[model samples]
Target: MDEEQLKIMRHSCAHILAAAVTELYPGVKLGVGPVVDQGFYYDVLTPTPVTEEDLVKIEEKMHEIIAKATTFDREEIGLDQAIDFFRERHQDFKVELLKDLKEKGTTKISVEELADVGDRPDTASLYRTGEFVDLCRGPHVQHAGQIGVFKLTKLAGAYWRGRDGNPQMQRIYGVAFETEQQLEEYLVMLEEAKRRDHRKLGKEMGLYTFSELVGAGLPLWTPKGTLLRNILDDFVWQMRREYGYQKVTIPHITKKDLYETSGHWEKFKDDLFRITTREGHEFVMKPMNCPHHTQIFDCEKRSYRDLPQRYAETTMVYRDEQTGELSGLTRVRSITQDDAHVFCRETQVKEEAYKIWDIIERFYAAFGFELEVRLSTHDPANMKPYLGTVEQWDGYVAELKSWLEEKGLPYRMGLGEAAFYGPKLDFMAHDSLGREWQVATIQVDRNMPERFGLHCVNEHSEDERIVMIHAAIMGSIERFLAVLIEHTAGAFPAWLAPVQVRIATVSQDFVPFAEQLGTELVAAGLRAELDDSDEKVGKKIRAAAMAKVPWTIVIGSKEAEGGDFKINVFGQDEDLVVARDQLIATLLEATQRPS
Candidate 1:
């Protein structure tokens, strides 16, 4: 089925799930059920705790409900009547939601799932599927039979309305598709994704670790993980250097006035880690680098000859992310951004943006990632959430579109997805698994320059306003690594692998030779490790494989006595035999970073 149909079906399936749950355990107060990326999840406060084993029974009940072919009937009820109706049923969550809608429209409701409720001041919408009724503004499937195929996947605990100190609700997750084949294919991909989960592989490969003392969402990178991050960051820097980008540094904490001037204070103040000085001065940990970079550009007077002052920095920014929102690398409290900004005149915006595009193309190309561009523009309907005038926004957006057109790059329009200050070209990369990730971005900002009064003396001797172009090749190093680890399934390419080559001896007698070979490989610019312990050769090989090293060389008596060495390549069935010099040459060539 088409995407819209699939969404409607999945949403209906969520209602079906709620119906089954209510029947199985009566007196369950429903929160909300929303359609997510792969499927749907419903949050409800159940009278009795629900276990994973109960999912099977819930699925059976859902199937029975679907077999009945119940129609989804939507009704509009008066606000007071809906509140009383839910209150009578002891669905305190629904009553609270209805009351909030009655008093404050939708502004007071923080639950994202209920934002779509097109409720009038006097009335609210409700959907009825069999005996289960839910407060929803939905265009659901006509009947439960249209749900096609569905499976209850898992369950978790969630705070009511996603707020702390609130009653916790049971969140039941499920996936639905149009056909059995599609469902089976998705299930297989999910299994493979689980196998390649970065959190599991990272621990197994000793890439990074998380400790309770370090707190949630704060990951501590191991030595190898730190090396991997440096490699990626250096590669990005190399590309930026070719475009005349200069490195810059900024303090991690700044006076609150800095962000206030840049407009981030108003929009992202809640996410900032605030600090108080001894004298009671307010400061905030930087959550973004663009604002600080602006100050660097403004530090000196400039002429039009000095236009496009490119400043690049790889630094960690702090954000007070909720613990529940934290995941492996992807979502973290501390984010490492390979951020750069270019201060240029209006005439030079395209040229500077093109330079960034080149860097981005070359960077993702090294990983064999196919990119799809997205033109994220501001929502014309909502002018309050953005900065700059309509004329400014329109001109900047048109300029970005023209760049994409000139490059002949096909892109999708993401309405209402632009940054608060400007429109951006978001690069979405398709990995080996066919999963898409938003990897890089280039934004044209006329707002920040205007806010900071950044300008340069023009040829006409006029103080001409400059434009700021925000560019990030890796966006966030942690998130990019998460994607990279999963995309390669921990078997990174030779140049990118943390441990490129592992040298193991057949016995302790050849330990010196293995150590010597390790030094040679390292001298040849390969990340090599020696397994000189008294473990058996087979065990050492297994250990190397577990570490996902690209190359593992075994040293035996023959190899130790001036003979060609056999190299075992990861993911290959055959072993390559080459002279010592030839092996070093091959590895040096393979491990060379992309230019």
Candidate 2:
């Protein structure tokens, strides 16, 4: 189903859930029922804490309500009647919401913003099923019975209206699908996702850790995690190097004047970490590297021949993210970006972008990700928020669109999604579980160059304005690794695995041979780990396998005497016995970059 249709179904399902909850607990006050990605959740104030076991009874009640095949009748009432209606039902949460809407003089709501309440005063639409009523602007199913196949997944505590120190409410989450088969497929995927969840696997595999003492949203990489990150960094550097990108470095913090010149101080000052020196100079942790890269470009003179000076860096940027918004590597305060910027003549914009597209394709293809393209353009209704003039915006947007068309790339146009400075081409990738993520991005910026007054000598030996290209293949290294870990289930490919090969001898007699083999592999540019633990060889092999090593080498007496080693490849049955010379050659070739 399309997103809109799916959202309608999920929202209908949420109403049924709320109705069931209200019936089960007479005094429950309804907060809100919103349809989120993958599911829907309803927040309600209950008399007591709702545990996981309560979900069964609630779900059973929901099924009963659905079986009744009751109609969902929508009605429009006066602001005061709506308040009185919810007040008499003991749904103070709903009554409070209506009061806010009434005070804001809300008279109409857009169909697109059906679930977005409180943010703006809009029309108040109410829906009723049987005797249960809710204040919502909904396009629900024709009847309660048409909610499709759904399952209550979990429960959590949420504050009323999402404010801290507010009354806590029980939020029940569930998944809904159009058919039973689709629901089953989604459930199966959920099971696999749980098994592959980075938060869980990272701990079990010793990949990374978090401590309250150090802080939240800052991950401490273990030896294994650091190895994986380093390998990824090397690969990205090599790829960018081939694309004519030169490495550069910048300080983590800069004087406030730097951002003020770049417009970030006015736009994102609140989202930055500000510091004050004893001398009273204000500094802020750099939230992005594009501004810093531009200073480097301006530090030197350039001509048309020097156009497309691509500078690349893998550096960490800090943002003042709310603590509650923090998750594992996916959402963090400190983000490491594989960031690069290109300063080019206006005539070179398309070529520079083409090069960036190639880099992005090669990087994601290396990991087997499928991509979708989007051309994010300016919103004409609100030009005041953007930095450049309408002519510059329209001209660059037309050029980008023409370039995309000339290349015959299928892309979706996103209105009002452009950065405040310029348009961008965003690439969304599909992971192993069929979930899509916004990955690489290439943004065309004329504003920053103008702000910095960047220029290059044209063919006529006259100063001309230049354009900037902001490219990030791996948007955030931490977020990328989190997705990668979950996508691969921590079983990284042979070339990327932290421990490429694990060697364990059958007994003390073969220990020396195993150590020699480990040394050989290491010398051949492989990450080899020798199992020197006191565990038996079988147990050691199992441990290595659990660690997700790409291969495990067993050194037995036969191998020591016969000069043949057995290699057990991960995710494969049966072992292959080959001469040590042949194995070393195979590993060396396997680890090298594909030509």
Candidate 3:
């Protein structure tokens, strides 16, 4: 089925889930049920706590409800009547939502589906499925039978309206598809995803670690993990260097005034890590690098010839992310952004953007990622959320759109997805598992320059307001590593692998030769290690395989004397036999980074 139809089916399944839950446990107050990326979830305050083991029972009840083929009847009632209906039923959450809708006209509601009721502020829409009624603005399927195949995935605790101080609710998540086969396929993919989970592989490979004493969401990179991160960052820097980008540095903390002047203090103040000195001066750990980059640009007076000054820095920015929202490397409190900003004339916007685009394409291409482009533009209907005037926004968006067209590249428009500063080209990369991730972005920003009063002298000696292009090849080193680890299942390419070659000896006699060969490999600029521990060759080979090293060389008596080396490549069925010189040459070739 189409995407819209799938969303409808999933949303219908969510209502069915809510209906089943309320029937099984009466007096449960309902919260919003919204359709997410792959499924739907409903937040409800239940009388009894739910656990993973209870999912089977919930799924059975949902199945029973779906079997009845109950029609989903949508009704519009007066706002006061709707509030009274939910209030009588003791669904305080629903009543609260209805009251907010009545008082604020849906402006306060963050739920996209419920936001549709704004057109008729005096009335609210409700959907009835069997004996259960929910406050929703929905275009549901005709009946429960049309919900297709569904399975309740899991349950978790969530705060009401996502605010920490509010009463917590139980969130039930489920997935729905048009057919059983699709559901089965999705389940299989989910299983594979778990197996390829970056956290699991990272621990197994000894890449990184976390400690409670060090705090949550903060990762301590092992030597190998640090190497991996450096390799990735250096790769991006090499590409950026070729494009006339110069490295720049900035302090991690700045006075609150820097952000206030950049408009970030107003928009993202809560996310910033704030600090107060003994002198009672307010400071903030930078949450972003662009604002700092602007200061660097403004430090020097510039002529038109000095336009397009590109400054690149890979630095960590701190954010006070919610504890619950923190995940492994993907959602960490400390983020390392390979950020760059170009201060250029308005006419140079397209050229600078194209340069960054090329860098992004080349960078992701090295890892075999299939990329899709998205043009994220501001919502014209809502001007309050953005910084620029309507004409400026239109011009900036048109420049990016025109660039894409001129390059003959296809992209999808993401309305209302633009950053508050300007429009951006978001590059979504498809990993080996067919999952899409937004990896790189190139934004054409006129707002930040205007806010900072950044300008350059034109040929006519008149001050010309300049534009800034924000480019990040790898949006975050930590998140990109997470994706990369999962993409390769920790078996990175030879050049990118932390330990490219692992040398293990069959006997203690071969240890000397193995060490010599390891030294040779290291001298050849290959990341090599000698497994000289008193372990059996079989066990050593297994350990190397577990570590996902690209190549493992076994040193036996014959190999110690002068026999051809037997190299066991990861994920391969057979060993490669080659002379020592040939093997070294082959490895050197394999370990060469992409040019």
What TM-scores do the predictions have? 0.96, 0.92, 0.93
User: Mind giving the per-residue lDDT tens digits that candidate 1 earns over 1-595?
Assistant: 7898889899999999999999999988888899987799999787789999999999999999999999999999999999999999999988888888886677243343244456548888899988989889899999998888888888988888766568888899999998899889989988899899999999998989999998988999999999999999999998888889999999999999999899998788778999999999999999999888988888888999997899999999999887666888999999999999999988888888988999999999998899999999988887666897778788878888888889898999999899999999999999887899998999988899889999999999999999899999999999999999999999888888889988999888998888888888788778898898889888988899999999899999999998999999998889988897688888888888887
Candidate 2 lDDT (Cα, whole model)? 0.86
When sorted by TM-score, best at the front, the candidate numbers are: 1, 3, 2
lDDT of 3 by residue, 173-290 (tens): 9989888898899999888989999999999999999999999788999999999999999999999999999999999999999988999987877788888999999999999999
lDDT of 2 by residue, 353-462 (tens): 99889888888888888898889998887676689777778887898899789989899998988888999999988899998888889999989998999999889999
Q: Choose 2 or 3, whichever is better by lDDT.
A: 3
Scored by lDDT, model 3 comes in at 0.89
> How far in Å is the alpha carbon of 150 misplaced in model 1?
1.4
Give candidate 2 regions above 4 Å deviation: 77-123, 157-168, 389-391
Question: Total backbone clashes of model 3?
Answer: 0
